[model samples]
Target chain A: MSVKLKALTKSIWVFHLAASPCNNCDIEILDLLTPRFDIERFGMQLVGSVRHADAILVTGSMNRKARIRLKRVIEQAPKPCFVIALGNCACTGEMFAPSYNQMKPLDEVVPVDAYIAGCPPKPEAMIMGVVALIEATLAAAKK
Target chain B: MKGWGKMSDKATAKTTIIPIGPYHPLQEEPEFFKLHVQGERVVKLEIEIGYNHRGIERLAEDLTYDQVPFLVERICGICSCSHPFACVNAIEDVGGVEVPERAKYIRMFTGELERIHSHLLWLGLAGHFLGYNTVWMWAWKYREPVLDLFELMTGNRNHYAMFKPGGVRRDFYEEDFPRAARLLDDLLRPLIMFRDVALQDPVLQARTKGVGVLTREDCVELGALGPTARASNYCIDVRKDHPYAAYDKVDWDVVCTSNGDVFDKVVVRVLEMVESAKICKQCLEKLREVDDGIDCNLKEIPPGEGMGHHEAPRGEVFHYVRSDGTNRPVRYKVRAPSFMNVPTNNRACVGYTVSDATITLAAIDPCYCCTERTAVVDADSGKQIMTWKELLRLSRQKTERLLEKYNSRMDRIWT
Candidate 1:
């Protein structure tokens, strides 16, 4: 856990992977880069390519079609990359869980390190999720 | 390889095809665009969708009438209210239940505010596409206050969940009026400034003006809706043509422009925001005077078929529901604005330079999440010389060159 935090020594580049999302979480993710939330100021930024990402932020309910693409994209990320499940769909599949098209919730398809709750969590909640990710690793390293 | 091997048999083999999508930042959703470029100009465009499909219509059949509103609200987060607005309208139409007069005003108020926020979001993305990062930042900065208003009113920023079959869920409190009024009043001066800057700015004009022309005939032929059609002078707004909720009750002019170019799309939206603000102001002021209670609770919907559509920020969000005297709808169909609007991009992007194609594709503000579930078949993508960065750099460089040209041409352009 502490070794994964080595990437936290510098800014963390997150690649936004929107599977079969409603797009509320995607917009809320973008909201972080806006003036009010501005995650870049805290040394977190969204990158266009997965190869450059230190962590992959996964959103959506992991429908069958997207599940394939999500698995392929996650496999393409560099080693030691962390996967964070965003929104209720990604964390627990929420209401969309029963749909025939929906695959397993995100964690079932890919290893997930952190989870952010909310149908589409507020920008503040996402920011806190990231901070908690770092804090948890630090606390574990102290042990 | 097989797909392209077959495609290569045509003259298209001579043209370099660039595929954008599935996971491009420009799309933000999973959809694909295949641009056939002859040198610098796009000769043809092919679009593929359905990557985000969660089978909402199929799922709607399983949910009861009461639970369907929440399901539809997630169709597109930005249009969360618009979806439910149309959903309830259809359910109400089926039941032949009349919405409360006060609820009409409250629903209109939320829908109008969503319009303002959605437009600003598009404006910000439009700015980013043109490499006017400052405008992008500013447009989004102004949008935060609108999101705050959504949170204050509906208790959630994205999915308002304000609508049900008979009427609305939340009541407009008089105590909330002053703050909402102040927000609208505060929004005016900046919006006016934004309109002036967006319309009159030389750099923006050079980048967008006369680019991606979707002729009025083209718009009609393609069945484009909302600003895409309005910009082309097609002049069809559901709010004006078929008034529902409080649209007929209130007075606000539908904003339209004749040019049918990318600039006209910007003009229609920028001007439309001012009009939306006026509607919000009117709804709030009149809501204070209306004494009718909200929610005319219709316990059960009778067996019948009904259809309802709202003029969403993007275009018409239509819902068709059929009841069999059961709590659940026997059949449900959704026709989102983007489903109609996205095809216009195929017509609009053609004949434009590759640099201009991105903005044109985005000009319709296509919501692939909403447009998804229509159709999708995997295509074999070949190697391409262009990356998303190269296309962005091409657009930015064009603006830089135009900036340099205009700077030298103007007499008063002293910097």
Candidate 2:
């Protein structure tokens, strides 16, 4: 792993962006911070500002209105920022995939580094997906 | 400003507007609130929503009756069961289908369990908003077992796909009752502890009590539901007022508090948790007496319109379904509790400070994702003065000040 990538893995602050989502995915994201799952132990914390974040955790599907805001948020984040798509809606648009309002999936809107797939993926799955994303980033940097 | 000219002439010169989230960290769902304040006191509050609009009702038109349950389940994760239950109830009402007695018990069990988890989740969030980290941790920790039970029974923690048109998708096995009862028994101690903390904690009382006052008359006029209305001493629980499922058969009292403030909202939710636990235990005992039977029997829905309303964790989750004797529904309307409760903020927040307004807005347990919808325009300078985080910090700072005051008092008493 490159020195920068290795250092990046030490602490990753995520800003949760809700693009039109059913709340199941958002609750699961919050659940990760609670005592049982406790994602803070891994040095992954949720920050209030997108500017202070190393990663953007996007939940929900990208609707026409939210798409504009999502773009602005992605652009505002510093370079080397990763996007982790959480839940089926974010990754695949799931139930709302064909709706007139929904524009695109998370990847089409912003390049996603990792995808956690579930109706609303469990906290354990979320942690594993995030950890794997960090490892993959480090591996890519080395290559 | 374009919009400020219409403001009350008395406070026109002094008001400064602070915007709270179309996409703010404090909000789990995307909602925008424009708080017009005069020296930290909120004079006028404007709410803008629709950021999370998936048009599920419109989408339901394309999906069949069976498919709509899973679709409506996604309306809000916390109240997932309520929507599907309401939807299924509406379909059953249209078709005139008889759900087996056992299925009714199962539906009640899942609905009550959802209530327990959702209330705990809200309590934890409320504690977090109040700057009480310990309460947040403890409440969420206790909530895990409820989710575990959901996973064990319905196969998913959040969106339990157990509801169908006539009945339910899954049935509880005879062996599961003993373990379910045991788990519920375990939850009682934590619930009591949470209740005690909410009742006796000086800081909590200072932070919440009398902060956001909603009158009983206002609650009724505004069409508030569940604990939001109940907290205001408006006794209108769907279970008691219009019992569906096995609610009429089971015995549980509606929890009501007269204060109509944020503290009363907390009180109503905590007390309701106790009631929910009792209902769950009773349902378990009753389930053992019923014979094993099929949970759902698919029957063609005749051409008719029917309404289904259930007491969701937040409030009344009302679903209206119209069928044309086809497989799909022609019109499906969902009115979640937050829909009715959020607008009441217009009246509830006016007399409070900005710090208190945060908790007051939260007191309704406003589901931004369910509402998914906001825009903030400053009336005075046409520039945004405060972000949602700043508003959250303002709210948290009040609690910190209260804690400091409490600590100093303790120190003086000790000396």
Candidate 3:
């Protein structure tokens, strides 16, 4: 049972939080789940709830209304959970930065461990972002 | 009074509230649906959207004619071109700009390709929600080639940004047409299989058929548009009623079904893919027929107000632009299909089980980004007076009254 548990623990469970996204980033995130990208190969599985997540994937810019909800979701996740900002809207706010609806950049509200930058970052970029996050966490653990 | 998420009112008997989002797996955007459930049946559904309120219309008022298309394209990632299709139409209407013949075909081609992509995305998501993971995987696999086609032609998978005021941004190369045509051809086999498999699958029919029904009266009264309306046996297609671009020139029939159930909605969307593919083929043939270089021909604008509506994948995306012969539109009004279609859920979810309500809402293909664009204004004063709090209070009162009436009726039936 411990051997099976150890083997299972290697796979990461990710919770996706869509914070007032136009859904471009969210849809691209789904692309990683679909068979074409097949993120399961990298020991990644998308969990439904934040509590079950090892990592939280934050998509979309931080809008005023959703920012509160974003914080709540982040709080709900298990301790030492990594938050990865996915796409330009989440990473840099992009064209929607000037809007009154937006609260602030995503990194301001949540400590974004890594950023996969694109209008909607391609799935390849997303895989690399997760790997980089894993490496950084490993390096930090070693230190 | 805090926000739509808070359950402040106690006017009705308490029921199990299954709050789906601000963030949920069922939907990609941050819209909340509060369901009042009694056992398995859902008595009421209060939709609290506006989380994805990017303030695009207000932003459009500030942007120039050239920039508005780019801004509006981001309204919904899936319906990326739908907003711009309406935006450019409004601009051209104001300027009385005659788009080149080739541009019309290119617009239609891109628009149909977008329709195919958006519908496939919905199909894949619908599959995912139903716990039909295989369907989700396969539907999305078929969709990859469509994105590849988009990448091939417009250089980006989503947000093609092909639409400009006068015409398309880039010219269609003669070489890409055959390859693009071939890619679209690849989608047909899987689409046919999907339609057949969905129609034949008993489990799917049992889950979806006669579930979340919106009657014809309910559809018209609620002003449901697009597939939501079409599923209800009501035919009101913007492409047919108000033909724009090459839609009038091309020959295609509006796909409508008798039942307004989730199953019929699925059927309508699946059948419509065939029609979109057919239309794209004809548009491609015509594009090759017409001179390729003359994709966009520019003309100057005169002061005027113009309205444009496109039959987006969801429904009609109506854009109203009033230009005072200035570089920017003085007022830009966008009415996405979901703006009207979303309210139909008020009736659609009334009798269905709690489990089925999500699929019913998804059947409308509600784009929260598109629906959250509007703000209430005093018509006489031409100014805003009602605060967001006031609006919430008014809506909550309505919700409370609905809940009270429904629970009281439930008590009578149970007793």
Query: What ranking of all candidate models by TM-score puts the best one first?
Result: 1, 2, 3
Docking category for candidate 1?
medium
Query: CA shift at B218, candidate 1, in angstroms?
Result: 0.7
RMSD of 1: 13.1
Where model 3 places Cα greater than 4 Å from the true spot, the runs are A1-10, B1-14, B292-299, B374-415
Chain A: TM-score in each model:
0.93, 0.94, 0.90
| lDDT comparing candidate 2 with the true structure | 0.84
Per-residue alpha-carbon lDDT of candidate 2 for residues B380-400, written as tens digits (9 for 90 to 100): 643343443343365467548
Residue A137 error for model 1, in Å?
A: 2.0
In TM-score terms, candidate 1 sits at 0.90
Q: What's model 2's TM-score? A: 0.90
TM-score for each of the candidates: 0.90, 0.90, 0.88
Task: State the fnat of candidate 2 relative to the true structure.
Answer: 0.72
Per-residue C-alpha lDDT of model 3 across residues B1-415, encoded as one tens digit per residue? 4655664456334578888886776678887788888766788777776577788877888898989999999888988999999999999998777788898888888999999998998998888888888888988999999999999888998888898899889988879989988988888999999899889998789879998898999988878899989989999999999888878899899999988899999999999999999999998899888874544555455566789999999999999887766689867878889978887887888778887887888878889888776434344653343333455466567558845865565455446
lDDT of 1 by residue, B1-415 (tens): 5575465445554789898877887767887788899867898887655567788888999999889999999888999989999999999998788888889999999999999999999999999889788888888999999999988888998998898888888787889999999998889887988889987899999999999898999988878899999999999999999999989989899999999998999989989999999999999989889877888878988877789999999999899887777799867888889877877776788888999988988899989788664433344532223333343365467658845754454323223
Off by over 4 Å in 2: B1-13, B372-415
Residue range A1-143, candidate 2, lDDT tens digits: 46766666778999999888888888888888998999888788999999999999898887776787789988999877888899999989998988877777889877888899998999989888988988788788787
Looking at model 1, the pairs that clash are none
Docking model 2 quality class: medium
Per-residue lDDT for A35-80 in model 1, tens only? 9989999788889899999889999887777787789999999887
